[model samples]
Target chain A: MEGRLARIGLRIWVGGVLLFLFVPIAIICFYAFNSSNIQSWPIQGLSVKWFSVAWHDPQVRAAFVLSLKAGVFATAIALLLGSAAAFGVHRFRFFGREAVSLLLVLPLALPGIITGIALNSAFSFAGIGLSLLTIVIGHATFCIVVVYNNVIARLRRVSGSVYEASADLGAHGFFTFRTVTLPMLSTALISGALLAFALSFDEVIVTTFTAGAQNTLPLWIFGAIRLGQQLPEVNVVVVAVLLLTVIPVIIAVRLTGGGGITRGSAAARSAMDSGSPGA
Target chain B: MTSTVAQGGRPGGEPASSRHAGGVPGGGSARLAAALWRRAWLRATLTLTPPLAWFLVIYLASLVVMLVTAFWSVNPFTNTLVHTWTLSNFRQLFTSTYLIIIGRTVGMAALVTVTDAVLAFPFAYYMARLASNRGRQLLFTAVLLPLWASYIARVYAWIVILQKGGTLSWSFQKLGLGAVNIGYTNTAMWLVFSYIWLPFMIVPVYAALERIPDSLLEASGDLGAHNWRTLRSVLLPLALPGVVAGSIFTFSLTLGDFITPLLVGGANSNFIGNVIYSNLGTAGNLPFAAALAVVPIVIMVFYLLGARLLGAFESL
Candidate 1:
C-alpha cells in the first residue's frame, strides 16, 4: 500500500507540472477571444472580433509576411548547406572534422545574446545595413545545425551497400544520388526544414539585432508590449504564431518521436560512425 | 557482332553503344560524376566548402571581431569606434555596481536551475519508469507542445496571472487565503524563468532516467537496500549527468535571457543580457556592451567545460 500510494503521489505531481506548462498557453488562447481591450483576471467576455482586427492591422500583416519570407529563405539555405556538410562529414575522413562539428553546434549551444551581438557588431563593421537579408543570414547560421543533425542521423542508418549497388549497376553518382539517396533522406530533410522554419519564425533576439526599420512577428510583439498599445491584438498574433509553429512541431515529433535529432551522443555517435560501408 | 565486341579493336572499330557511352550529351554529366566519385578528397571538399565558409566567415569571424572591438573605445563626440585600444570598458565593468549585476544574474540563474531540477525530476522519473509507452508518448507531446507557443505570449500570460487582482489573487481570495500580488518583481522573474526553461530540463532528465537499467535497481533490492537507499546510491548517481545536463540549459538560458525579465521583472531585474542590449541599442556603446557580454561568455565557457567534465555532453 505504501508503494502504491507513492506511485499515486508521483502521478499527481506530473499532472500538476503538465498543468503549469499549459496554463499560460491556455491563457493566450483564451485572451485571443477576450472582448475587453484590457487584460484582467476574469476575461470580460468572449468574442472573435480581435482576429479580424489583427488581420486588418497593416503592421501585423507586414510583420507576418516578413517572418514567413525570412523563415523560408533561411530554411532553404540551411537545407542545401547543412545536408552537404552532413554528407561530407559522414562519407569521408577529413582533418578538422571534429572542429567542424563543434562549430556547427556552437550556435545552438551558446546563448543567443552572444550570437546577436556578434552578428550585429560584424554587420556594423562591414558597413552592411541591417535588413531582411541580414536577418536571413543570422537565422540560417543556427538553422544549419538543425538540418545537419537530422541528415547526419538519417545518413548513419542508410546502408553503404545501396550506394555501391547503384555504382555496380552502371549508374553514375548523380543518377545514383537522385534514385537512391534522395528518396532515403527525404523524411529527415522535410522534418529538419520544418523545424528550421519554426525556429526562424519565432526567433526574436537575433532578429532584434539583425533587423533595421522592420519587424518580424516576435519583434513586433516585443514593441507592442513595451509601448503597451493594442494589447489584445498582441494576443491574436500570438495565438496565430502559436498554431503555426505547433503544427510543424507536432509533425516533427511524430516523425522523430522523442529522440529529437539534436538530442545528444546518439546523433553524435552516428556522425562519428566512420566504419559504415558507405564511409 | 558478339565476337567483334569481345575482340580488341581500334577506336573506329568499337561498338556503336560503346562509342556513345563516352560521347553523348547525357554522358558529359555522367563523365563528370564518375570523375568526382573517383576522388573522395574532391567530393569532400566540394560538399564541405559552402557550410564551412559560412561558419568561418559569418559566425566565427564575427565573434572575433566583436571580441576585438571590446578592447577599443568609442569616440564620444561622434559615437564612432576609435581604433585605439583601451581597457576602460573592462575597468568600468569591474566596479561594484556591474559586479553586483553579474552576481545577481548568476544567483537568479542558479535559483531557477535548482527549482527546475526539483520540479522536472519527479515528472521525468514517473514518465520514464511508470508510464506505459502510449502514456509516455502523450506526455512527451504535452511537454513539447508548449515550446511552440510564442515565448512572449507565455511570459505575458504570467504577467496576467501575477498582476494585481489577477488569477492567483482572485483564487486566493475565493479560498479565504487573502490576496497576494507578486507582479513585476524578481520573484516573478524567477517563476517565469523556471517556466520557460522547464521543458529543456525535462527532456534531458527524462532521457537520462529512461536509460537507467532496471537490473541495477533490482540488484540493489536483492542486496536488501530500501527504496530510499537505492534512490540515493544507484538512481541519483546515474541521473547526475542528466541533471547536470539539464542544469546547463536552465542555467545558461537564464543567464543570457532578457525577454522574460523585461516582461515580468520590475525596475531592478536587469540581467547581463539586458545590460548588453541597452548599452548597444540605446547608448550606442558597442565596446561597453561587448565588454558586458564577455562576462556571460566567460561564465558559460567555464560552465560548459564543467558540464562536459560531468559527462553532460553525452546526455546533451
Candidate 2:
C-alpha cells in the first residue's frame, strides 16, 4: 500500500515535469497561428496569416539559407576532421594523445560565450573578416568534437580484430577500410553529422561573434524578438525552425538505436577516462 | 596460407599481394598505400595531423590570443585596442559593480542548477525505476525532444506565458486569483533558466539511476530497509555524481548566457555574459570583453576540477 502510494506520487510528479517541458513547445506551435500582432492574454484569435508573412520576409529567407549552408559546410568539415581524429586517437598511442582528446573536448565542455569571444578576438587579430566562412570555421571547431565523440564511442565498441582479419585476408588498408570499417561506422557518422548540423543550425552565440553583419536563423530570431513588432511572424519562423531542428535530432536518436541522447556526455566521460591514470 | 605467411614476413607484403591478387592496376597510389600500411607511425601522422593542426591553429591559438588580449588596454576615446600590456582590465573587473554582476550570474547559475536537480530527480527516478519499458522510451523521448527544439523559441514561450496579460495572468484572472505579472523580472529569468536546462539534468540523472543494479535496491530492501531508507542511503549517494554532472551544464550555460537576460530580464538584471557582450559589441572594448570573459573560464576550471574529484566526469 505504501509503495503504491509512493508510485502514484512519482507518476504525478513526472507528469507535471513533462507538462512543464512540453507546454511551452505546444504554446509556440499554437501561437504560430495566432492572428494578432501583439502577444496578449488568450491569444486574441487564430489564423494562418503569420505563416505567409514569415514566408514572404526576405530577411527570414536569407537567414534560413545562411543557417542551412553553414550547418552543411560545418557538418561536412566536422565529419572529415572528427572521424580522422577519432581513428588516430583510437588506433595509435602517442605523446600528447591525452592532450589531443582534451583539446577536442574543450570547445564543447567550456561555455560557448568563451569560445565566441576567443574566436572573435582571434579573427580580428589575424585580420580575418567575419563572414559565412568564419562562421563555418567557428562552428566546425565545436562540431568536430560531436563527431569525434560519436565516432570514438562507436570505435571503442567495434573490435580492431576485424581490420586485422581483413588485412590478413589479403585486403589492402584502403579495401579493408572501405569494405569493413566504413560499414561499421556508417550509422555513427550519419547520426554524428545530423547532430552536428542540428547544433550548428540553431547556434546563436558563436555565430554572433563570427558572423559580423550576417544573420543566421537564430540570430534573426533574436533580432525579431527584440524588435517586438514581428511577434506573430517570429512565432511562425520559430515553429518552422522547431521542426527543422527537432526532425534531425529525432532521426539521429533513431539512427543511434534510441539509447537516449547520452553520446555527448558519454563521450566526455570516455575522453576523461582515457586521460586518467587508472581509467 | 603462403601469402599469409609471406605477408607476416614483410609488413608491406599484404597490400602488394592484395593489389596483385585483385588484378587491380598498380600505380604510385598503391605503392603509397603499401608504405602507409607498413608504417603505423606514418598512418597515425596522416590521420592525426589535419584535425590536430586545425585544433591547434584555429581553436587553441584563438584561446591563447584571447588570453593575451585580456592583458591589454583599450583606448576609450578612439574605441581602439591599444596593444600595450597592462593589468587595468583585470583590475577594473575587481570593482564592486563588476563584482556584483559576477555574483548575480554565479548566484543564478547555482539557483538554476538546484532547481533543475530538484525537479529532475523525481521525474528521472520514475522513468528509471517505475515506468514500464514502453513508457520509459516515451518518457525518454519527451525529455529529449525539448533539448533539440530551438532554445530561443522555448524561452520565447515563457514570455508569452509570463508577460503582463499573458497565459499565467489569464489563468489567474479566470480563477479570480487577481492579476500578476512576473515578466521581465529576475524571477522570470529563474523560471526560464530552470525550464531550459531541465532536460540536461534529466538525461544524465536517468542514465545514472538506470545503471544502478536492481540487485542493489533489492539487497537494501532485503536487509530490512524501507523504501525511503533505501532511497536515501543507496539511491541518492549513487545519483550524486550524475547530479553533479548535470549541474555542470546548468551552471556553465547560465553563467555564459546573455540572451536569457537580454530577452527575459528587466533593467536590473546584468549577468557577466551581458557585461562581456556590451563591452565587446557596444563599447568596442575587445580587451575589456576578453578580460571579463576570463572570469567564467576561471570559475569553470575550478568547478570542473571539483566535479572531477566528485566523479562527475564518469557519470557524464
Candidate 3:
C-alpha cells in the first residue's frame, strides 16, 4: 500500500513538472496571435495580424536570412571537418589519439563565455573584422564536435571487416569508402547535420561576441526585447523559429530510429559535450 | 601464396599483386595511393593533420591568446593592449567587488543544480520505471520539445509569466495567495534556469535509473528490505553518477549564462558572466574580462574532475 501511494504521488509530481516545462512554450505559441502589442495578464485579443506584421518587417527577414546563412555554412564546415576527424580517429591508432579526442571535446566542455571572449579577443587581435564569416567560424568550432560525436558513434557501430573485404575484392580505398561507408553513414550524417543546423540557428551567446554588427534571429529577438517594442511581433518570430526547428528535430528523430529522447540525444549530447549547451 | 606471388604469376596465368607496381591506366597514381595507404603511421598523420591544425590554430590558439592577453593591461588613452605584463588585473579582481559577483554566480548555480536534481527525480523515476512505452514516448517528446524551442524565447515566455499582474501573479491571486513579485529578481532567474535545464538533469538520471536491473531491487526486497530501504540501497547509489553528470551541465551552464540575468535579473543581479560580457563588449577591457573568464573555467575544471572521480564521465 505504501509503495502504491508513493507511485501515485510520483505520478502527480511528474505531471506538475511537465506542466511547468510546457507552460512557457504554450504561452509563447498562444500569445503569438495576440492582437495587442503590449503583453499583459490575459492577452487582450487573439488575431493573426502580428504574423503579417512580423512577415513585413525587413529587420526580421534579414535576421532570419543571416541565421540561415550562418547555420548552413557552419553545418557544411562541421560535416566535413568533423566527419574527417571521426574517420581518422576511428580508423587509425597513433600517438596522441586520446589527446586528440580530448582536444576536440574541450570546446564543448568550456563555458560559452570563455569561448566567446576568446574568439572575440582573437579576432580583434588579428585585425580580422567580425562578419558572418567570423560567426560561422565560431559556430563551426563547436559544430564540428557535434558532427564528430555522431559520426564517431556511428563509426564505432560498424565493423572494420567490411573495409578489408572491399579491398580484397579489388575495390580502391575511395571506391570502398564511397560504396560501403557512405551508405551506412548516411542517416547519421543527415541527422547530425540537421542537429548541427538547429544548434547554429538558435545560437546567441557566442554570436554576440563574434557577430560585429549583424543580427541573427536570436540576436534580433534579443534586440527587439531590449528595446521593448513590437512585443507581439517578437512573439510571432519566436513561434515561427520554434516551428521551423521542430520539424527538423522530428525528422532527425525518425532517421535515428527513435527509442525515446535519447535517440536524438546524440546531437543533443554533442551540443552539451561542447560545453556551451545553452543558447 | 608467397611463392606464387614472387613468381609474378598465379594459377590462371595472371600476374599476382601487380596493381601496386603498375598494371592499369594511371597506374602510377594508383601505386602511390596503395603505397601511402599501406603505411599506417603516414596515413594516420595525413588524416590527423587538418582537424588537429584547426583545433590548434583556431581553438587552442585563441584560448592561449585570451589567457596571455589577461596578463597584459590595456592602454588608458587609446584602449589598445599594452605588451607589458602586469598582475594589476588579477589584483583588481581580488580587491574589488567582483568577488561578490563570483560568489553570487556560484551560489546561484549550486541552488539551480540542486533544485533541478530534486524536481527532476520523481519525474525521471516515473519515466524510467513506471510509464508505459507509449506514455514514455509522449513524455520524451514533451520534454524535448521545449529544448528545441529558442532559449531566449523560453526565457521571454517566463518574462510574460512573471511580469507584474502576469500569469503567475494572476494565478496566485486566484489561488488565494498574494502576488509573486519575482519578476526581474534572482528568484526569477533561478526559476528560469531550473526550468530550462531540468531536461538535462532528467535525461541522464532516467538513463542511469533505467539501467538498474529490476532483479537487484527484487533481490533487496526479498532479503526483507523495505521498499524505502531498497530504494536507498539500490536506486540512490546507482543514480548518483547520473546526478553528478547532470549537475555539471546545470552548474556550468548557469555559471556561464549572461543572457538570463540580463533578461530577468534586477540591477543587483550581475553575475560573473555579465561582468565579463560588459568588460569585453563595452568597457573594452580584455585583460579584466579574461581574468573573470578564468573563474568559471577554473570552477568547471574542478567540477569536471570531481564528476570524473565519481564515474560520471560514462553517463556524460
Evaluated at residue A99, the lDDT of candidate 2 is 72
Docking class of 1: acceptable
- In model 2, the Cα lDDT at residue B4 comes to 31
Query: Candidate 1's error at A266, in angstroms?
Result: 7.0
- Off-target runs (Cα >4 Å) in candidate 3 are A258-279, B1-33, B314-316
Across residues A123-221, which tens digit of lDDT does each residue of candidate 2 receive? 989988888999999999989988887788778867779988997787777888889999988988997898888889988878888998889999999
Candidate 2 pairs with clashing backbones = none
Task: Write down the worst ten-residue block by lDDT for model 3 chain A.
Answer: A270-279
For lDDT, the strongest prediction is: 2
CAPRI class assigned to model 2: acceptable
Comparing only chain B with the true structure, the TM-scores of all models are 0.89, 0.90, 0.87
What interface RMSD do all candidates show, one decimal each? 4.6, 4.7, 4.8
DockQ winner between 2 and 3, please give it.
2
Cα RMSD (angstroms) for every candidate in the order listed: 7.0, 5.6, 6.3
